[model samples]
Target: MSEQRETRQRYNEEFKRQTVKYIQEQTKTVTEIGEELNIPAKTLHSWLAKYRQFEDEPIINTEKVWEQERIIKEQNQQIDDLKEELAILKKAVHIFSNSKK
Candidate 1:
């Protein structure tokens, strides 16, 4: 008779940290993130628990994290808006220059 063994997938610390951060962001439920990431909801919940409990201290202040994320998102949006505006201006300049030819 042959012995059977079970194999489990392993995730790195960085991946676990990022997953916990994503969970803290509250953008999606654990079940949703689990489904999207192909990880079990129970596993994600466990990671959240372990990471959140580290040193019995809050990791980087949730308020500050959320605020920084919001600021970054806003800055990204502004950059995207400026890029779109520049493209439009370039197109207008090209059209006007062609008209003068």
Candidate 2:
């Protein structure tokens, strides 16, 4: 039997930016805006933080890239070790086969 599938939705950054502008223009409190928009106040606050773009204004600091460079390096080291082990195993197999001659 085929099960029903659900689709999730997300708003683009520009949409959030415009919403912030609308909120500012209406001078709406966060709670009221949240209720009217059917969005959590905290989510609106996050949009306010990241999407604020104005001339001579500080850039938004909302989205920080969370790269795990250290984890990548560790994984590379593991791959190198596995390659070395495979090479050693191949050499051992070669030597034992020649010894039977």
Candidate 3:
């Protein structure tokens, strides 16, 4: 039998701080952000708790906030497109049914 070793990941202080800041600014839960970023929720939670100690002088990255906004805008646009497509399909169905009647 062969034994395998798992390697642990290391994150820098700036990355940790930015992640904590993201969690604070975004509406997403810690688990959701962790899944998106491929980080563990527990790690993110710990970073957030550590940063909370200096809540009076929190780090705010404008570029990250803008990036998040762009992503949200794109998602909203995709949702709108899906809704329009659904409406068109429903109308087509209604027309087909009426024609068959």
lDDT of every model, 2 decimals: 0.86, 0.78, 0.85
Error of 2 at 63 (Å): 32
- For model 1, the superposed segments whose C-alpha errors exceed 4 Å read 1-7, 53-101
Answer with 1 or 3, whichever has the higher lDDT: 1
Highest-TM-score candidate: 3
1 or 3: which has the higher TM-score? 3
- For model 2, residues 1-101, the per-residue Cα lDDT tens digits are 13323433478978898888777666669889999988889888898788755643434454422235666788999999999999999999999999999
Candidate number with greatest lDDT? 1
Task: Report the Cα lDDT for candidate 1.
Answer: 0.86
TM-score of each: 0.45, 0.43, 0.46
RMSD of each: 10.2, 16.8, 14.0
**Model 3: per-residue lDDT, tens digit, 1-101?**
13323456788999898888778878888999999999999999889878754554446889978988999999999999999999999999999999998
- Which run of 10 residues does model 1 get worst, by summed lDDT? 1-10
- Candidate 1 lDDT over 1-101, as tens digits, reads 13323446689999999888777766788999999999999999899978864543456888989999999999999999999999999999999999999
